[model samples]
Target: KPFVRRLRGDLLAHGVPRVWLDEAEIDIGDSLIAKIDEGMKLSRYIAVVLSKKSIDAPWVKKELDVAMNREITSGEVVVLPLLYEPCDLPEFLKGKMYADFSKPDEYEAMLAKLLRRLRIT
Candidate 1:
């Protein structure tokens, strides 16, 4: 709920675009390579909503793998993850830094922080 709401608000506030793998135009068929390629090609930045559920999801893991690779290969596709619920963030995201959305003010602050982190502010 929070993820979709925040994403909508972000889309409204900034005309920055976003895409979901499930709703993507391409046919992935659970292919790792295909998902990675599509994600990198279609999105300028990737926001992974990390939680125990998403963190353990195979799709999320694959996307992160692709995002990490893209980060290395092109230094593009910035992966900005928001905490939907309290859970342990993976090592990769843990090191890069993330905005906490555990509180209302923190969430809003994180939203602003994300803009600044991405240099949109």
Candidate 2:
């Protein structure tokens, strides 16, 4: 959660217009599936923060499926994989170039690369 929070903060600080983080956007009585779907649809890019535990999460799988489907339908890249830990990536995301934040020292450089991709600067 800290990693995500930090990423969100940095993205916002760097002038990302909007960031749809589940914890920040979802309310107590909201429908999780609907909110996630809406977020995926509205986002220009979906950043999947990958880790050992997250790779096996059901919600992650569902989210990835939705993002991949959107990419197929829209005929554009919609998913950005952010490697936060050393782990084997999902087959679908294996070919995508990712911003690696696994090394603490590389955070700034990786973030810069990500911002470039997002055209934020």
Candidate 3:
């Protein structure tokens, strides 16, 4: 939660345009599915925070699937995986590198790596 908030803030501070959906941004009467679909369509990249909790989350799985498909169809890396903890990564992500953030001390290194991966100046 806090890590994600921090990441979002850091990304924004770097002048990277980002779209993140939280309960506060989603209206109570709005459709979550529609919002997610629109966000994915407009986003240049999808940063998936992988952890034990998110790995089993259905919505996360769905988001990963969509991102992976976009990567295949668009012939570009759309999904950027940020590993928060050790877990069995899905087959699609196996053998691929991730931005490691398992250690608090690694935040700067990981953020740099992530920005490089994003091609941010």
**Candidate 1 per-residue lDDT over residues 68-91, each given as its tens digit:** 887888865478887777898888
Error of 1 at 13 (Å): 2.4
Q: Please, what's the RMSD in Å of model 2?
A: 0.7
> Which one wins on lDDT?
2
lDDT at position 106, candidate 3: 92
lDDT of 2 by residue, 24-51 (tens): 9899999998998888878999999999
For candidate 2, the per-residue lDDT at 34 reads 92
Segments in model 3 whose C-alpha atoms lie over 4 Å from true places: none
TM-score of each: 0.73, 0.97, 0.93
Model 3: colliding residue pairs: none
lDDT of 3: 0.87
Clash counts per candidate, in order, are 0, 0, 0
Compared with the true structure, all predictions reach lDDT values of 0.71, 0.94, 0.87
Give me the displacement of residue 92 in model 3, in angstroms.
0.8
- Candidate 2 has its poorest 10 consecutive residues by lDDT at 33-42
Residues 1-121 of candidate 3: C-alpha lDDT, one tens digit per residue? 8888888889888767775746536688889998888888888989999899999999999999999999999999899989998888988998678998998899999999888877787
Best by TM-score: 2
